[model samples]
Structure formats: C-alpha cells, structure tokens
Target: MRIKTTRQQHILRIKTTLRWLLYYLLIFLSFIIMTSGTLYKPILLVPLAIAISINNNIYGSAVTGAFCGFLIDICCGKLFGYNAVILAFFCILTNLVFELYLKNRFINYLMITAVVSYIQCWLDYKFYYQIWDYENVGRIFVRVSLRVWAYTVISAFFMYLLVKLVNKLLMPKEHLTIEEAINTNIQNENKR
Candidate 1:
C-alpha cells in the first residue's frame, strides 16, 4: 500500500509537470503569433494571463503571468520587467479575488479580464506614449491603445474556453465507481 501510494504520487507529479509545460508552450506560441507583424496586435497576453489566473492557484497564476509578461517585454522590445511585474501582480490579485470574492463564471471572467486589460492598456499608453510627449499621442491612443483594449476583451472569451478545456483535460481521474469500490474492498478482505 505504501509503495502503491508513492507510485501514484510520483505519477501525479509527472502529470502536473507535463500539464504546466503544455500550458507554457501554448502561451509561448500565442506570443509568437500575436507579435507576427499584425497591423494592430491585441495585447493577447493580458486575457491569456487572466484566464490562466482564474484556473490556477495563486503561485501558479503568478508564475504564468510573469512568464507571459517576460515574453511580452521581449517581443515589444521594451525595457525588461515592466510587464513582468505588472502581470504577476495582477495575476496574484486575480487569483485571490476569484478564490475569495468572485464566482468563477464566464461573465465574471470577462468582466475581470476587461478591467485588467483596460488598466494594462492605459498604463502602457501613459508610460510609453503620453509621458514621452510623442507627437500625435492622442491619435496613437485612440488608434492603438483603445483598439488593443477592445480586442483583448473580446479575445478573453476564447482564452477562457481554452484554459477551461485544458484544465478539464488535465484533471485527475481518481474517483472510483461504487461497483469498483466494492470490488476493491472485497479483494482487500480476501487478502486479509
């Protein structure tokens, strides 16, 4: 029994590691696609991060967010760690809020994704464009930032579905049916 339990634990750990690796691969591919010379690319990572946060624990969410943000910074050619810090912070907050206060519903996820995406877009615009006093900053804000926010929010629906599917697929199938349980109990009694 002890050996069986240990084996099961080791298998569970391997499964968990594989699941996270798949998630990271998905996010990395998403970043590549999002940054592939689109005319107006959405901040795809925001909704993705938020979706991940909703599905994961606080530590998982934070790590995923930081990973996504680090990719964003690299792709955007911005200073390192800006998006990393912001995304990690928001992901942690999202996990806590959802765990405590908010129900994990589709509508709630969309609302939270919208709010967080909006804040991220606004911060990006304010720091990169507005503060720099670039010419036609208002035009850029309207044309770029607002559009990014809208697209990010719209993409949240898909991201939420995708993450939920992944979670479902990775969930452990540990429960035994009544018949199976009874059979197992009988076998144990016979052995005793």
Candidate 2:
C-alpha cells in the first residue's frame, strides 16, 4: 500500500478545484449568451437541458438549469418561474435516466434533445399564444414546424459540440494503474 505524498495530494485538490471553476465559468458564460438576445433566438435552452442531463451531477445540474431558466424567463418576458420549473424538472429527470441506463452517447443526446425541443416549443407556443382552447391546430402545427428548425436544431448541434469540447478540456487525465505506478517509480529510482 502506497500513500500519496502531501504535495501530490495538494496538487490533485487544486486541479479538481480549478476544473470545477472552469466548468461553472463556462456554464455561466453560456447562460449569458443564451439570454443576451445576441444570437437571434437561439435554441440554447434545450441543449443546455440535455447537457445537464449528461453532466452526471443531479444537484449541480439542477441548480444550473434553474439559473439558466431564470435567465431565459427574464429574456423572453414570460411569466417568471415557468421555464425555471420545467428546466429543473427535466434536468433531474434526464440525470436519472443517464445514471440508470444511458451512457451519454451522442445519439442518446440527440434523441433527448429532440424530445425536449418539442416540449419547449410547444410550451412556448401554448403560453405565448394563450391557446388553451386548441381551436386553431393547423396554425400551431405550421408555426411549430417553421420555428423548430429555424434556429433551435442548429444551435443545439453547436451547443453539443461546445459541451463536448469543454468536457474534454476540463476532464482530468486517467490515473495510473498500480502496475504503471510501480514501473514509473522503478524507472525513476534507476535514473537516480
């Protein structure tokens, strides 16, 4: 049994802290981008929901979703707390599914994103148009169809790529196996 040196443990802690900071910073920046209206109605929320699902941290993802949803509500000028509630629910749900069955694959993300996108669009349409009676089904369908692909789908792909890249950058390298560690120590001793 080998114990890690104090310096080594300290370094590891620092690395972990730094990684978390980077991850949160990235999320914050993305939240700002989504709310700033700079992208001409980007579909950032759905992808963000999917990203939280794949994030593997229920509490953290839920919090992030809530924050982003709040920002979204502010930007859209809709009733406060509506998007926040929906996004938080989806975040928790997605995290559970990913933890139990899914492996965070791209295809899985795409399918999940598509479903979420549909739900989001429907909700937005319903709430914005106040279509409780559902009288004009044709117009709703046409509008949904046009807006679904107009920016959300493409923005989702972009957000996916961004998430992947950020994950790759922040993820720590794999730890050495016991055998590798021993070999490394032996090689270092030989050099000394």
Candidate 3:
C-alpha cells in the first residue's frame, strides 16, 4: 500500500510584502555566512548551492545563489557579476531538474548540484578567465573541476546535516510543503 503524503502548512508565506523583506534578509545573511569564511578554499560554491536547494523553494534557491555569487565577487574582487550570472543559471537548472526529473530526492540533489557547480567552474575558468595559459589548463582542471566533484560529493552529506540543523533551529511550527502552497493559493483565490 502506498503511504499517503500530507502537505505541511506554513504560517509564513510570500503572500505578504514584508515576507519579501524577510527573504532578502535571510538571503543576505546566508550569503555572508557562506562567503565570509575560508572553509577549504577549493569548494566554496557547492555547499552554498546545497543550502539553497534543500528547501526546494525558488525564492530560497534564487536568493542563495544570487547572494553567494555576489559575495564571491566581492571577496575575490575580480570580474564583477560573473558569479551572479552563473549562480542564476544554476538556479534555473536546479529548478528544471527538480520539476522534471528528480522531485526532491537526495541523489537528485547531489547530482544536480555537482553537475551545475562543475560546469560553472569550468566555464568560469575557460571563457571568463584567460589567466591560465594552455599548459595550465590541465592543472586548473585538476585543481578546480576535480576538486569541485570531490567537494560536492563529500559536501552532500554535510549538506544533509545542515538541512537537519536548519530544520531544528529555524523551522516554523507550521511550514508549507509544495502541495500546501498550491492548494492554499487555490482555496484563497476561490474565496475571492
């Protein structure tokens, strides 16, 4: 017998304008935290991506990506807007994969994030950066791409832990599951 899955209800909703301000604040804080410290030095982006992807909310995903990328830009003090553009792209890719293929499975999260993060780094090096010469390509690949895979793969578990931690700390008494959000909107509209 298939078990019935019920949607969780949210006390907070994007239903309000103030909620958007909350989103911005959360995004800004998350971005600062993700960018502030030097974790391992090689794999900063993956965990940040995971942090955003876990909630499976578009607002969270976009905000996390946008802020993380901006932080990188600010810290690296290099090409402006590069990280932002790439992260936004990752947001779209993650959303597409979630909607079409994965449906919020753990493996899907790992695979999507790993794939997107790797591609972003590779492109960042290849097109946006010519700092490295032809001979350095192999070295860069080993350092950046390979490291990213390792980072994402290893970071996946920690990401899970982080989600659980967030759930414990910041979780609401009632929060909207994807279904609840849709149904709530539908019902609210019918009343109007």
Best by lDDT: 1
Residue lDDT tens for model 1, 1-192? 122355666777787787787788779878987889775777778888988888678999999999889988988877799999999999999999999999889998888889988888889889999998988899988998899889888888888888788878774556554567778899999999
Best by TM-score: 1
On residues 50-125, what C-alpha lDDT tens digit does candidate 3 reach at each position? 5555555677677667766777677556478888777876876676667666665667776776776677667767
The parts of candidate 1 lying over 4 Å away from their true place are 1-8, 173-192
Tens digit of per-residue lDDT, candidate 2, span 43-162: 576676567558647987787677767877886787898888888888788888988999878888877777777787677776776566667765765665446535776677777777
Q: Given candidate 2, what's the lDDT at residue 187?
A: 100
Clash list (residue pairs), candidate 2: none
Least lDDT summed over 10 consecutive residues: which range in candidate 1? 1-10
Candidate 3 has a TM-score of: 0.61
TM-score of 2: 0.72
**Cα lDDT of all candidates, in order?**
0.84, 0.71, 0.60
- List TM-score per model, in order: 0.83, 0.72, 0.61
lDDT for model 1 comes to 0.84
Kindly report the root-mean-square deviation of model 1 from the true structure over all alpha carbons: 6.4
Identify the superior model by TM-score, candidate 1 or candidate 3.
1
